[model samples]
Target: MSSDPLDDVFNLEDRFYTQGYTQGVEDGARAGRIEGRSFGMEKGFEKFLESGRLAGKAIVWANRLPKKTAKQKDASEKSSEACTLPPLPSNPRLEKNVKLAYALVEPDTLSTDNSDEAVQDFDDRVKRAQGKVKIIERMLN
Candidate 1:
């Protein structure tokens, strides 16, 4: 027995609709993943760049700190001509802040994982480092 013509026509339309929907879903899923990965990489790069900048500032601050021992002072004085930055006044609090900032954004200490906990920790460290930088700048000015 042959199927009814009208039924076949309706079934054809339904089949085409289903196929189109499936194709669209597959395409969308693929595109979404690509876009998400690209976005994630860009954001990660930006965060790391900022962290590196903060770390660099910490290193410079640490270097510019006055040497403690007589022997150290003599060594720094010899190299002081190469160092354009004037030595930071010997303030215990400033020294502490600089050290803390360096520890916060230190590359070896930070995780590169994409996990939620790792990301959160990275963000927290960066934020703390930023606060330290601001405090150091204010003290300098």
Candidate 2:
């Protein structure tokens, strides 16, 4: 039966402070998680959009390559065994075209001044890209 009034008061104050500190930490952690998720999703969406644009341009350039002839198709089919793949042509010109096409569409290749821009001034850029694509297409001839 030791009822020390000062000890009770100190215990009460300590308990209240601990409760408040725990709640604050939990609230801060929750907010941080929400912000982190939102930031990640926004960045992911931007990357997805840029990848789509790059793929579209790459597809246009890829279409410039010759289609597989019947003989090539048969060759590919014959090599369709498990873990086996058909070989691509050993043409250095084809390799050069592929590298140039990928370089043209790669996000990393964007100019530093425009890298962080939200909206692109794409009219002139698009025309120049099309001109490059045309040159690559002609190279296939």
Evaluated against the true structure, the overall lDDT of model 1 is 0.97
**Taking the tens digit of each residue's C-alpha lDDT, what string does model 1 give over 1-141?**
587768977799889999999999999999999999999999999999999999999999999999999999899989998988899999999999999999999999999998999999999999999999999999999
Q: Which stretches of candidate 1 lie over 4 Å from their true place?
A: none
- Native-to-model Cα distance after best TM-score fit, residue 102 in candidate 2, in Å: 7.2
lDDT for model 2 comes to: 0.58
lDDT of each: 0.97, 0.58
Error of 2 at 54 (Å): 1.5
All candidates: TM-score: 0.95, 0.44
Index of the highest-lDDT prediction: 1
TM-score of 2: 0.44
| Candidate 2, 1-141: lDDT as tens digits | 678778877799889999999999999999999999899678656654664465475665454343368986565465454423233345666656555655655566544243435325333343455565565557556
